[model samples]
Target: MKRSSPANLGAEKGQKQPTMEEDKVRSLFNSKIWDPEFQDTLKNEIAMSKPYNWGTIRDLIDDDLLRKVRKEIETEIHFTNKETDIYKVNQSGDLANLSGLDWNDLSRLPSLCRLREILYSEVYRDVISHVSGAGTLSGSKMDMSINTYTKGCHLLTHDDVIGSRRVSFILYLPEPGKRWKDHYGGGLRLFPSIVANVPHSDHSAKLVPQFNQIAFFKVQPGFSFHDVEEVHVNKHRLSIQGWYHIPQEGEKGYIPGEEAEWVKTNTSTLAQLESNVLQDYEFPKNERNILPYHQIRHFDELLAAQTSEHEATESSVDLSLLSEGELKYLAEFISPHHLTSAGIHKLQSQFVTKSQLQIDDFLNDTKSEVLKKLIKTDELQKECPYESVNVEAPWKTALPPHKWRYLYIDGKSHENFQTEQDILNSLNNEEMPNYNLLSKTLDPVKNNTETELISVATFLESTAFKKFLALVTLLSPLSEQVLIRRFRPGKDFTLATQINKNDLLERVKGFVEAVLEGTLCLTPTDGWESGEVGGYELYMDNQDDDDEANTDIKDAAVYRSDDTGDSVLINKPPSWNSFNLVLRDESVLQFVKYVSWAAKSSRWDITAQWDVKTVDDDSENDAE
Candidate 1:
């Protein structure tokens, strides 16, 4: 399941082999594997297993045979490096293709080919079914693959609910006779469910696997949530991961339309993604509420009248857009260079060329120094809260771990949103982001710790800030949302996702299916350049321009987002006092990668989004 795409890693459907005697099948496995007393004990353990029905077996295969099989794999197979939003590892091509190999191919990997036959053999399936109570599994539907999780490799949490998989198993092939310790990482972690479909953030159970042992569980939709812990040491955690599926057309337990009906119920979360169904369930929705009434009324008309429909260039700053008093207010937070004509002209050229811009030292030195010290002090002294009860009001946790989970200040408090109704109440009677109001009300002396944060946030929400943005992007903003966010090390991440353009399209007459987004990263730490420890913001092109779906994506719901791939448009790691601005459309999928537990500190940043209208450039084009 930690693959780039869905895989049916098995050989062709196996026909029932009535001629193969029970003795012959029994001889293929370890002498202890098929013992009725041993299986009965395993069955009882599985029935009482918490989280889900899962069990393990040691020395499942014959020792000499397995050793030969491992040797063949080493000599014959080639593993390819893969990185995705969810996982990273090196894996061989589907072992299912092993069954279809020509005579020449089979000769090269004879032991591997022979091992596959024994595993899919009908008698073996019966043995597995009996112990796990998985009634009548198909010997044909063997989906498996060979993979190795070396240093830094990992898989995130999710239920193994893709397609019609009946059971999931992992056979570890670490060095023979060696003990894999818990601290070495690469453990198989299982999470208990808060409810039937929702899992708790922390894992309650873990498996520190051993050589030649296989861990297995039934594929229970919503309940079987697990993840592979990242391997920390410079050693190989080689293993074979596979799945058993419902019977095919000719298999013994096959039923009419059984597979199709199963697929309807047990599809990937991705299949229903980008639709309103899943999004409506997302808590603390990414909704950009309107700015405060006073700010809008005081400056909306003047700002609107000042905005021209002309294209920007390396031209002089528009001093008329900001009055002398307004410019003075902005200068306190923004760098003097950014306020000058030369700075504006340089930004104009960058935006015009690539529709994006990145500016270091965007904030004035005094403000930057204050932020760096405040943030670094908090990271060093304050212990971040991990539980929901500990997360205070004003700052809330983004919910539904499958999509995202991070601490954020969204400028309003509705406590926790539990259902669609809760979201509706908030949306219908909208509460806008009022950093200015929060700054005015917060007790400066009592909350001296948060004073500078509020000051920075208030400035970001200022009308002059929007004017600067409009000048740079040559667009007009109708509504905006500002958030102060912290991606805590080891606990926070957002999956790859895109926004609904239709939502923006419905708001204004010329909405243009676009949003001008900005992030002012304030993380104060080092060693983030390589991205091995996660905590990077990435943007990817979702699909081809003509709408041809990516072939690599299948029903199993995984993506191979190699860092160097063409799909990646941007990858930005956490840094101090840097600002990035982009005018992005719906086609761009964006996310913050999971922060590793090994990271020095939290990834801190202030994010902003604007629903903007592209102005007419007809007059400016004529002048050019």
Candidate 2:
């Protein structure tokens, strides 16, 4: 680790310097004051505390000093949207960019620099150690200062507890004269959990800061649900926000090679973490469709006309596959504002029937509201029971995580549902006004070509694609969205369509062709029951069983394996690279009708059949 000189510590040197009194308070922060009285107070005052209001060293920096810093930042700073592996530079949500702003111009911002030092200081280490007692934070180094939230800027509620985050802290830097008003918005909001895994919005913790005040909290996993209220006022809510990473030598929390060791541990890959989240939504552990990696070989297999069939005993986990009761329960929890009595009446008719007579009607509607209600409710349900299918051909599970990922439309990939509004705004501001129509040009030959290309672009720009993008954004480690617009006269169009649909039919054909050309990456094996320790398999501990025999069932082995070979190979879960049926114009029309029907039916098994075009068989192949 590198060290900055004392002189480089900046303008707030006086405040950063601890006095004897400050030292005593620091000692208290370091101590384990876990007595019953203290514990109860903490619980009442802080633990179960609603809308917490704790801030640190509020007036650590003087106004004149801050003004100078703001001037320097305003002139010399050049903020761009912050980019990350999970989130891209949001065009609509993000406008100002000071991340690339040179720190040299920020010298006058004494409060900013001072906050950083204290955060990376011994004081912070002691405070966190006392609060969390989670040993010391470790892993990814926090190197940059992201100062990019302005009016209307907000971040939705999510735990900052990504792999190995030690502590989360924010420093305030609103304009000098005006108070950082709550109405001006952009205040930090924290949510209280109904249970360890479930959170309710009934109560909240808001942090509206004054100049130089800093707020810190340990990164509590599944808890610590926080978001930035959208700045309502016209002014920018400037803040020097950062994190105090786990110990690094020469730094306050430094431990010997501790950071590197933790990084090597690979607590959980981004993909695995995503899998865990999706698992929360009705996807059973073992039976979930675990697709292959996004490799060329798998791509080829998808293009062939073969199905995947592995011999293993079916799982017995009674997941809420399609229960109308479960759907009603979820409607209460995250219910859409547009709910209507008509929709409820519709749902009641089908849900109450539960009779096999309406099974066909139930499986015929796969509309947005229906899917949304079903999936969202399923998401609220923590455990996914095993499901069995009697369909023909290659049999596999369609695990949510395995299928959803960053999906690209036009040139952009959407990873979360929240991003669609931003995407539409970007398109309107940058190019098109409305996506319903296309901009026409006047060159007979060129015009025709451009018109077709624009249609493709328009299709990519469609609301469906935007919704698809949002759906995939929440899929996992590949959370970042990216877009690259290109016009392919004839050849480009074919390839784009093919690439957009990277599913079994396409992959199988591609694989078969490659095999004939002697480029097959084949590793054949008899599928194992519970896959080998490292292979793609589900290891489930019985969670719901209450009886003693069920307790044994909990320990009983439940595994679903893809291959049973002596050769050790890595197994990659599936990707929805080319599994988009919703993108088709016909699909969209049918989808709307299905949703309308679903609002009334509230039934889950809304199945539809489409002919999958195979490589050898140009004719459509059908199976349910």
Candidate 3:
């Protein structure tokens, strides 16, 4: 049924009222959008929208019809749990397949079917295209799916630049009578770009949707970056997400080769990002700065001499070989129990078998008490910085945010990356690690949490720590990165990512390549042990699959809806004082889950990584 145009609805005052066809058109969508003045306002709003060209309208769908549609969705749809490195949500199979539904589904979803038709109708498409200035849209190729964001569901930042999609939209359908508030979470957040393809660390604006509201934007590649904030409460957030495709053949305004040109111009950013070809644009670049030449040579010489002397043989490694002075330096940070010969033997044996270990009470009593006390007090007394602008001296936010977002102290003279120029300057003037400056600046006597953490990061970089590491893992360190990271409640995380195989292989010359990873968890909270409230360290076999249940993901890891089973080899929740060590190859993917807003405090930890090599004669296979 064709709806009358706005010109037909524009009858002069006291002349004739809207025609019957016009009334039908006005009744489906909110009547206000048919007004010339309102359309003009919407056009201007889209033109001036920040981060990208976008606009939203409240009460877009007729309330009664939408409520019926929501009920049909609730009753008829089978929502599958969809998860990935960047998002987690319950998703329905494509609504475009509504006609192909089985008898029960088809009979139960009449209102949903109507809603879809009205949405893709020529009348509605015209309003969207004209307002957003997207030239044309196809009615034939309807691409849409339903998503429900329950508690813990989230969608990370991405510019919706897929093939032929000219405009993107989401029509919200929360509980009909309830108001979705700002504090409810699940807000649609827009991020301003630091440069093309580089979104800032934090969102610039957010929209808390109400029932029958619709938010949309022109698909502007490299500029339209947005995310759905994780829903924190137990409320169902239902939405219809769809893209208006560029006109297809025989459609009005169709242009040959337009889509192909657009596709070539806007290649998937994920492919380029995974390869790290755009490293310069990435903040806190994943590049691991090598230790000084003398230090590298020292480890090389130590490994060669140890091999020649038949020390730390294939059977076991002896930590007791450490000089008294070496033991004393480590005693300040690591528990003496972990330094004993028995401790080293047990740990080595376990690592030799499993290639991994998680040790509790990893720190000495003095250091543990000091750090725990300081962290707890700081949480109670000090406010955590929620904004990059509020992030004080010494710490920097990990960015462009598609990859990760957390606060870290890299033991460098920190500068805020406020603009494209700031980041460019950093790339132009890169420097190597300097623990000397870190020691001179952050005083251990300050009794401050930040300073204490920085001190720990520096200590972890020391030769003494590496000696103990070499003893247990039986791999000689070639290069390393030690970072003191704070995964703030509600705001920090690392998306799942594999170690760059090419980079690690290049660093480790010929014999087997591996990276030794260690996590020292110092979180002072309590309710995170179950990994239910987030803040967990997870490692998975990247080569595995989620099975045929999810065929869309080609290179998937086997996963249960709750993230259990053999795929997840290790899952450690936020803890008081513990250390986890693992030697992993490029096939392993690792990430710290995003901490929930309900958590008591930030998930504080010191993360350490080292590129290493196997001894020439040993033939033990990888234990992963």
Candidate 4:
């Protein structure tokens, strides 16, 4: 064989030399990115950051290459809108896994592949490792997804603590030259931690994104709570979301139990107080603890005074056309239809048949208009202080925000418990704050002009209203609780679940819950159709496997999706002058979906509950 030159020998083995163009493409990242001084500065910034260790880099990549990459993504990728409990956004189903794609696939998206290669190159990986102090991230285990948040899209709070993730990042690619305004609202909001696993209610820091900028942080489990604020207006916030994982077996920093330890420390679970203080905080506490005999007798005497015993025993109680005095009190808030005989008959018949009633225009037009205007003004003009420490008297933030968050007039006492220990102590002391006092206190503060919310609550708690409820449900109310609530836009919600039942309260037939809601939808933008932006109240039949065996099964609040044939009774949105009444037997699950920041206004309502007595069907049949 002829003696071959070195180049000829390499060609014989099918090896190709790197071209000048390939070398230039590989160096698409900023040269200064690899400088030691730059890396140290980034590291220091992350170390000193508040809420958690995080940092941002502007113009992280070569300007021309990033622009080309953005063009490729916009033209070549298909995106689909995804919605779940955790987030809502448009996402590209095509994952950025370069190693898995064949040459044929790579050829179709050359710029994207090049961008991915440069981002995961060893030099960049080392830079990220040094800055995050995450130690030897796995370059081979690339994880990234492209997402677009248009108007109304949001990602709820969550800590990126799952699996072997060491760092998380997002690279923004909005319109190339236009600046994204703060009012547009798609900011990365970081939350402070209250304890090991609990995050504070409000976000402490927000980073408004820009084209060619990247925000990143060490994924510190519970300490890294963050969320994407809803995009407030019509615009697209495109980004590439990715994570750097801990080193694999052959890579550096592959500690065997590090991931497991992180999971153990950051796993989602109820706080100690949530499990132990149910009776003290939740409604219908000790449901079996019937109203005292004297109290029931007192209500009975009131009913007897209104109607003769013979008239009360008739199939229908004459609740229509209340005395002029009672009607006048009710007319202040109640709709004329509800005060009429025909309306009461219609509602009573419906409640008897379905155990639920929804009354539209529940409040008179005049009252509804005034309340709506007042609520709209307050929601628009008043700043809602979310944390309990910031809330003023007459308006208190609901406690243990892990369960719910809102401002409410509980009408009893004001007890602001700042710590979990304080809550536990109060529970142990059996302290029950009376919301009635809160209502009274609010009256004087509003200059004796009781807020429309207070007026509604007052009417609901009045003995006449209770009698009206009794007539509709054919039950005798023994005791009741009323709450005037303001579910702040973007900050309040109650998760899907059931009422808490007391074994002692099981002796009574059931309880009644009524919500008179007026939505002050002030969302400057539309698209809150169906339940997309949430804020809807939902009710479902409780699916308890051992319901029959359990004495208080009807009062049990537990719910499961897998239970066969469970069904929903109602799903209604917040409306002006609407009233919903549900007769719960301990087996109904209900919840208010989290109101989105996109909502125009707060969800204002009067909520009330009554423990009532029901005649046993068997005893009634025997007497008949």
Candidate 5:
């Protein structure tokens, strides 16, 4: 590749002083006025800058000297787009082990050493000291390589509020003497402050470089937002980027723990922390399905009782609820293709109607035989559907009364609950009749039976019941491919208040949105309404409830009759659980697929997967 020199458009010359140190400081570094005071002044001047605005001194390095350094780096260095980090790098040359590389390694590359010498010369030292207002002059290190942003390349806005970095600098390297034309692209665009803490959408300061120009800025967290304008032509716009970390010990103004102190004070959100360069690989492993600390402890305490293999064996069979015959019946009903319309109609009439379906009748049906066969073939039937437990030969869930209560019971702290009277008081609380009834259903304490019964009715009116309906839809025998688990009020749920009805409903909506975005393959057209659920037009009559109500269980199951399509248990199929498990283990694949599909540029593809309908008159024509 042909080497290019750093750009220095509209270079201004500063007079060299009599003393050698003064000469270097005056010409090689930015002027004293443009250091800290200039930054503060610019912060105030740029109304576009947010409250946390800061800028670096431009023209710090001599243009002639910088051009030479840029040429050397461009010719000698190698580059690779990390396939890992979002950035690219030349790791094997002078910048090898850059994060831990010593500053002295620049000697290996003569041009880089020369560049450093000019950067930290005595004159520059005074300028830096005056601008930074720091007493110490520690060794400066350059670790990154020249990056070329060509056609279609772009970076989003973000603050460089990472650990210990005090200042950031980039030296542009394009063809020397050739004006990096405005239309040719590749300009350093600086954001203007919008408020104290945010930046404007459009750029306020643009540095279009010639050869040997250098741009520097203070590393202001949460305020600095800049991007390199993408090059439209095939030409490369290269730049050497690096950071100046906080001063080391023995340097003036270097506090022993200042770096650590700053980091401790600026806490990142879980989302930002996961994006750290060093922590990216470990993030998914640590984050996926991560239960809160309390939930983990609760599970640990509950599991502590099973000390022996005998206890584990005893916990598998649930004779009281689902016996051998019931398991056999379940296996039959769960077949992917076995239950067609006729079987569905027969089963709904023979067993499901009147809510009089006995477990024996459900088990004896021919469809039940399908479920039985599945249970017999499968070796890993979990007890708590929410939890995975091991079984030896026949997969069964133990239905021991306390074990049942332990897994399904809803128990939370109540202020007054020490003795029998306390328990009675909790049952009598006007706010807790439903909870009291469920408590009675599990243990059926002799006292306060009437209040508990009334509480059961209250429970039926709750949103949790609706959530349970949705979960049952997921776990139904006909759709074993779909996995569902309840977000228990105080246990499985997070990110929202467990007991807040509105919050819980919002969570359900979010879950629906995520599934639609990720798994449901959609076919979209323009006429679709914003929240349309089904793929195409729905001939739903906007009549009274009586018109919509089904006369019986079979009627309710027939969601629509015009389309002879088998009533789909789900709107569409979700990604296989096995595939998701693989993805959870392999982050690289997950990221590639996720970025390709979930990125803003490809959001339309996701919308298409859900079969989003269009509102246009021709939308009906398109569906056909």
Candidate 6:
């Protein structure tokens, strides 16, 4: 490999020519790194590694020089905390194109400029190529950034399969000589792919990084799944992340169309994973497969009994004031205000116009106080038992931490999987865990419910409460699932997206298909001011060009920082005794943002969903 001149050093009009001192400063890498024997050993190790081909080298740079570089970076560089759907970390602006910096810029941080050159030098590139067998790397086409993951910062699962990328590497610069402990988290965890694009739920390997160590891997599209574990303590995990690109034109090993070919193959693998065969693994898992005939009949009977008793009224019905039995059942948890005639009228009118409603002080004062106290006690007193195998019953952690990670009552007894293969096999067999059985077993009213979680689930699932949902939405409930969720600080989130619709399911007469969702929030602390520290439920209008009618629906967002046209229909933050109800069509996107580590307590909520039937327009009119 031939070394290219630094991008910023070449002479411009009235600028001084490159000097010998600059060249000497750039050659700061450890010379022993270029030895043939070392390179060969690294190559063999990478080829033999499990999950993926990756290797790490210790003391790859001159220690004194690296220390100097780290000091310069600490004193001179300004970092901005950046957050997005994929990552949350403090980072400096791009350091890759440092050659474009003027002399005045370079003069202030000479060590950083030299460090960039040393990492991208021909000698270092050759060694990297020999070890990883990633072909020729570009010297001129540089790409690198400095990032610091302090407490609670994390990067979720992703393959560094972006444009023109060939290899990826991270050089750690944690406090020198003081070993970065495993319990402090911030390890680079690697996931094994089930197939090309499908990654398993958990990471199989992890590298606990230290100062002066560089971890590099060939950038395998779809297969290179990795994430930075959330830093557990108030410590900084600083590193330089960069990529070696396929050689550009005029560079050795440059092949026309090579980059394009890699991109095409990567995109095809992603498309493959999105096919119907893999829908079972997707989050929200296949649109609540229809209930069995016996189960449906049971729910139908509940509705039928209610229908026989309440005669059709000429004016709008008050869902708040239900029959004596129903109101009594609901009063155990539901707020009196929400059940009032005026409150019911307000909620019904909002839902009629907007398809969603948010209710605060959702639970009656006495029940709300008990539930909140129980939840707060659980959060403060109970230690979360998260294990790779043999996890405790009633609560199971949601998997594929790339998507979401929270303790949820799957409504079933917890089953443990010892390995990625065990999980993959379970998924392949289509073994849907019986969350309903778990719910039934834990229902406080029905069984030995030892906790508020069980009591909440039981209340949400009561026939009377389901009837209340029907009255408010004017949609008859058929099948339902209720989950008591605990989103621990620094541990959980769900990304925004619409549910997949099953077009094949037949629509029942006098009914349109919809999912009725209700969430009763029990977050016990403040500081969830807006969307910051997350744990906010957001609803956005689905962008679907196929629906011509929806084209006129302005693009919007709930928690938008700026007024761009994306429509955000609703945004609700975590609050005590708050409840949100949304009647969703297939065209609405919903998600709860990740809770930050700074939260004083976990976000507690009882989530319920019902597959419902909409009444015919004439019948609705008659009921009104």
Tens-place lDDT per residue, model 4, 61-150, is: 888878887888788777776543335577675444344455345565677666666666667778888898877887656666677899
Backbone clash total, candidate 2: 46
Compared with the true structure, the alpha-carbon lDDT of candidate 1 equals 0.72
Q: For model 6, how does the per-residue alpha-carbon lDDT over 1-624 read when each residue is reduced to its tens digit? A: 001111112122233323335346345666666678877887999999868999998887788878887887788777766554445677664343354576456666777766776776676788898889889998767667777889867776767665567898999999897999998889999988766555665788999999999999998876888878888788989898887878777778889988777665655332333344445444334345454545344444444443433346423454433568878778878788777656665676677677778888888888777777766666677775544343466666665444556667645555454455655665666545454455555656422323555766767766677666765665666566777777877667765555544454445554455677889888888889756577888777755444332111111111112124355677788988888889887677677777777777888888877776654434433222
Best by TM-score: 3
Candidate 3 segments whose C-alpha is farther than 4 A from its true place: 1-27, 80-84, 93-99, 102-105, 292-316, 443-447, 501-511, 544-566, 617-624
**Pick by TM-score: 2 or 6, better one:** 6
lDDT of 3 at 444: 62
Per-residue accuracy of model 1 over 1-624 as CA lDDT, tens digit each: 112443334555453222346676578688886778988898999999876789999888877778887776677777776766777677776543554555345667766666666776788787778878877787766667788888878777777776677888898888777898888889998977654455555667889988888999888876788888888888888888887878888778899998889877765655455564556545556677655545433343433443441224325656666779878988898889888867876887788699888988988998898889888888888778876547764567776666677887766653554444544675576566666666665667544545677677777777888777766766666667778888887678877877655463464444557778899998899878899888888888876333323222243445654444777788899999999998888888888888877889999888888776654434232111
Candidate 1 vs candidate 2, lDDT winner: 1
Clash totals in order? 1, 46, 0, 21, 53, 14
Better of 3 and 6 by TM-score: 3
Give the runs in model 5 whose Cα sits over 4 Å from its true position.
1-60, 83-108, 125-145, 189-210, 268-517, 520-603, 607-624
> Which ranges of candidate 1 are over 4 A from the true structure?
1-8, 12-22, 93-96, 103-105, 195-197, 291-314, 386-395, 414-451, 502-507, 544-556, 561-564, 616-624
Give the lDDT of residue 322 in candidate 5: 28
- Comparing 1 and 4 by lDDT, which wins? 1
Q: Which 10 residues in a row give candidate 3 its minimum summed lDDT?
A: 1-10
- 1 versus 4: better TM-score goes to: 1
Every model's Cα RMSD, please?
Answer: 4.5, 22.9, 7.6, 10.8, 23.3, 7.5
Over all chains combined, what TM-score does candidate 4 have?
0.73
Best by lDDT: 3
lDDT values of the candidates?
0.72, 0.32, 0.74, 0.62, 0.33, 0.66
- Candidate 6: lDDT over CA atoms? 0.66
